[model samples]
Target: MPLMHQLWLLVPWAVFALAAGVKFWRLTRPFRRQLAEPSTEQVRASLERRWRADQRELTE
Candidate 1:
């Protein structure tokens, strides 16, 4: 693999790590939200997409 190609693998992990960090940080905060989660469909679709992509990475 090329040098840049190897870096591609690192990028996603970095992004996920950042996202998790942010989420966990949010959980520790005391902000009250006036909004509800959009919908089950949207949530499911996002999770499905994330799962599929992760699966493809592992399989490849």
Candidate 2:
């Protein structure tokens, strides 16, 4: 096959890859935001409460 034909074959694959990448980024956007943002004070307090409860259980 000619080089031009080979290059043409790659076009669809490239488009599909770009589309899939965009879809994946959109789907994971919320998770990415959570990772990027700092934990809020309320979340920190809730985690501390849970840790204290677990510690009490461990001591008993």
Candidate 3:
């Protein structure tokens, strides 16, 4: 194949790869934000609160 034809064929693949990468980044954005904050105590407290609520419901 000629060099020009090869370059044209690669352009579509490059665009597809870039689009997939962007989609993946968007999907994981929420997880990335949460990891950036490092709020372990708050998460533990929230889980504890939910557990207490569930226990109360079960007892009642």
The local distance difference test score of each candidate is: 0.87, 0.93, 0.94
- Candidate 2 residue lDDT tens string, 1-60: 999999999999999999999999999999998788576886899899999999999999
Measured against the true structure, the TM-scores of the candidates, in listed sequence, are: 0.46, 0.65, 0.60
Cα-based lDDT at residue 3, candidate 1: 98
Clashing pairs in 2: none
Better of 2 and 3 by TM-score: 2
lDDT of 1 by residue, 1-60 (tens): 999999999999999999999998798665434255558898899999999999999999
lDDT of 3: 0.94
lDDT of 2 at 52: 100
Off by over 4 Å in 2: 39-44, 47-60
Candidate 3, residue 1: Cα displacement in angstroms equals 2.2
Q: Which model scores highest in TM-score?
A: 2
Off by over 4 Å in 1: 31-60
User: How far out, in Å, is residue 57 in model 2?
Assistant: 6.6
Encode model 3's per-residue lDDT on 1-60: one tens digit a residue. 999998999899999999999999999999998788558898899999999999999999
lDDT of 1: 0.87
